[model samples]
Target: MPADPESGQGPAAADPAQQQQQQQQQQQQQQHADGRPAADKPIKRYRRTELEEEEAKKKLLLLEEEGDEQYEEYVPRKKRREADEAVLMRLQGLAGPAAPEGDDDTGSEIDDEDEEQQQQQPASKAARPASVPQQRGKESLLVQTARAKKEAPPESATDKVLAEEADMMRHITQKQALRAAKELATDTVYTRSMSTGWKPPAEARGWSARKAQALREQFHISVAGDNVPPPLPSFALMKLPPPIASLLQQKGIKRPTPIQIQGIPAALAGRDIIGISFTGSGKTLVYSLPLICIAVQDEMMMPLEGGEGPLGLIVCPSRELANQTVEVITQYTDALKAGGFPELRVMLCIGGIDMRAQMDMLKRGVHIVVATPGRLKDLLTKRRMNLDICRYLALDEADRMVDLGFEEEMREILSFFKSQRQTLMFSATMPAKIKTFAESALVDPIEVNVGRAGAANLDVIQEVEYVKEEDKLAYLLDCLQKTAPPVLVFAENKRDVDAIHEALLLQGVDVVAVHGDRDQLERLEAIRDFKGGKADVLVASDVASKGLDFPGVQHVINYDMPEEIENYVHRIGRTGRSGKTGIATTFINSRQCSESILLDLKHLLKEAKQRVPQFLTALHDPLEEMEALAALSGIKGCAYCGGLGHRIADCPKLRSESKAQERSKKDYFGSGGFGGEM
Candidate 1:
């Protein structure tokens, strides 16, 4: 009773008195509630060995279910509602405002009224009302979402800066004005000369051998001379003195052109050269370099006397050519002086200026004289100029000089020079007569022919039209409307030149006319205006064909076919110069196509690889047949009397025989005899 083994009981709870009281209370409670005293719960216990066996059994049956299941219920993935989904989508679409009848699947909502308006009207017409302030915005927004959208407008050319620049350009002075004009001219030449896609050589030394070879092949350069000099690899290889070479470099002449390549060396070596190249083939430099080199040498060797004549003489065919040559030589000589070389004096003795001034300049001692044949011959006759001491002679446009009937003057000028002087002849062509003249003029000359003799510039695209003489003005107007300035128009005579000039003026075209009839000042002014871009077109005769270098000429129009085939080559060469491409349009009448002209033109086109017109190709010149007939008949008809061997115009036998006949007649019919009366 002191303590129970498994129960936490104090000695007081085990007391006898307390037990007796508890039994009494329990008996009472039993009687009151008909309940017996609460019985003690029995304790259940297991051996430690049984507990271990139970844990072992549980471990052995580990796969047996433990408590509640944790995995999701097995249900097949919900089958796709194939047919029902379509109905659902349709229902969803129907739930929204019903789409218009012709509406596409685009999820846009359109007003019923706007839809009706769009359906009732054409598509191009806007559906919005004019009175609505937001009409354009609404339609543009709609169009932004539509299948087709209108293209945006192009940007305007007028900008704030452009307006200001234009205003500023209008206030420039004459010199500044010329500068602006020449800038455009230079820009045109630069743009055309260098292709947009071409890049400079990487090394910058000069054109590589591969590049130079490509140029030779492209330009079809043919070189034939004693020890035919290889094209100068660069200006450095020219073997020129540093001053001269640097001067050329400063002038923007980095390398030799095809003509200059072969021609310069031949002339420099003291060989008489017959340099044949197309116009603008850098022919000026062919003789110019030699002239300068010799001048420098002559000056360095001995100081000039006050009355000494020019050391070098260059004769051109026209005053314009002589002037142009003088200007170019002056530029180069100025460059030479800038490069530390002795000052070389160059003067122009061309006509249309003061002869007395030219005489005065000559007396003061000039190094080089560029003159036309007429003026030079006049000076020579008056003893104002001398070529007796001249060691260098050049005849620029030699063929043209001869063609212009300057043979006597040329012979006279050549005779005045020492027979031992070196000579150089540059011509666009070398015809039989020029060849004969060259034989007498030049000794042991090296021939440098670039391409074919008298060939058109390949850079010029030639087009021939069978136009009537009277309709040329109308046709030219049409062409001008399509082409850009500056245009050069060639006519056969001064009358036609003036007529075309007047017609162009009437049509409100800026134009100038130059011909033989124009005074020197007037002609110079016309050329100046044309070059300055003040005149869009220059109407001219054959006088503009040779030696004048007009910059940035984009087109050449031949309103009249040249009477001579050689002149044709020169006429078209006006446009395409210095590597710039141009177009040449020739107006020809079928009736005027002579056999010689037709043959020459066709051959030229074929050689240049240009397209030949159908009319020109189809034409059969009858003169060829006549020439064949004449050859077979051995007629060799004369130009004057239709006789053989001798032209009646220059036949001494005919003249003498006529004189003898006249004398006999007078003798026979003396004093009004019967023969005279009959």
Candidate 2:
């Protein structure tokens, strides 16, 4: 009843009698109290428009004739339809006698027909019903919808997209739909396909335990941390830019990854180290910093000693990866070139063009030489590429080096290295075989391993799709036809490899085929073609899974499921690399699969702790995720996000790639590492 302090006013325009009562209330606040200074009258603030709107709403509700009780109905008035003839009149006036009166209706009919046909066809895929007549308003919308629903491809946009949405929901797994979306809507298109069989040799049934042991030895890890590493030493103290340091800090990479931490220090100390880690781990930096450090050598420049071939020698397994590493190394080199290395020269000796040019470049005198095992071996044997002056020797991807059957070559290359030179062997896995190879190649060296490629990297999704045995080819065709981007199709035998390659070619699809049956030059050609984007698909055997790198491939299809699970690991490893987004689809059916295969498959899924996606069909029902997680127990960290998560969705770098001019993030598909036969 008293005027509020914030607003010294009572309700305005009250009745004269009420105004008198209000005056009494005001007087009470000044000691003529009637109820303890009259509960400080609650403030009432309202704008003129708001007050009028409330009043108008109340009046409308009060005037409602039909409503029984007082209720303000939320009446959103329907918009009036525009006159259809008005557009016709305007068009007729413009065109005069040239446009007939009914021309507009005919045009509308044609447009409706096109829309109906488009709606009927599934997204990204070509209209499969060659004979189905295009029906617009000929049938009831309900009837046509029902028929089209049944007729459309199961992997099409209709099934994946909710009808309620204005736009179709996308299935990243549908290649055809994604391509269509790209063309039709000018949106980034993503396509996917599923294949069941064509297993890699690592997952082959014929391989004996000795072979598994041999494969294991290819990447022999001597150092398994007795305890979790003392939270890695941070590189924050190195004083880098915010963006670069942010990634380093996020990974808790204060000092460096294990490989970088160990290898960098040893190489800086001018000692050799045999470093091993997973593919995504930072191995380039491990050897690079030390190389740069050695090159600078307290002289604030990449001092070039004329006639010195190179100060550092980097031998990689694949040309693509070698090229990629050179790019990263060069990026850092350029930054430090001003103060540390002004005229640092890096010579690349990898396959895909001319050896003469490479030799010419090498002879020009460079500070660093990045090369592949075979090309370097060839050059070394030819005495064109020399390491006599090279003090630091780094074997990037050592497992792939051995796996690609370059151990003998590596041994010979190492014999040329002086015992005083530092030798660093980096790989995904380090078994006894790698150790023996290293023992023969390297001297006493510090051992460092961040992790091995044991189970699937969480970001690299691994799943199995069961198709009927007869449907395998159709499934593969559907996958290739439906999935966009490049695919690496793995086949068990050379015959199936050729069959699929020929079939894809007949479909007017660009494909490259590689297998053991093919000669070295031919395989190299196939790989070169695929890497160049001249070939869209590659049908290959286990050899492709070795050190072969083609970074653009977004999908890996098992045309025939690899009987041995490790082969599956190697096959998919082709798609998902360096923390890029990739998918692996394995075709599993009754004929190809058995209890043991499913068990191994299930075991992998269990170890990954990922639920079997609904797209994946199998004889046995998938286990509960919590149970799998409990069984697997191990927490998998995303290489990109480091979130202890799985899949591309959770990977920060991958997510950024899709959103951030990422197509060139690093080809998941890369140039071939091995030579194919003619």
Best by lDDT: 1
TM-score of each: 0.60, 0.48
lDDT at 239, model 2: 29
lDDT of 2 at 19: 72
- Alpha-carbon lDDT of model 2: 0.57
Candidate 1 global CA lDDT score: 0.68
Off by over 4 Å in 2: 1-235, 238-272, 296-302, 334-340, 351-353, 436-444, 468-470, 480-486, 493-498, 508-554, 563-565, 575-581, 589-602, 611-678
Best by TM-score: 1
lDDT of candidate 1 over 560-631, digit per residue (tens): 787566678889988778888889999988676554466557657876888888876776644343454335
Task: Judge candidate 1 at residue 345 and give its lDDT.
Answer: 85
lDDT per model vs. reference: 0.68, 0.57
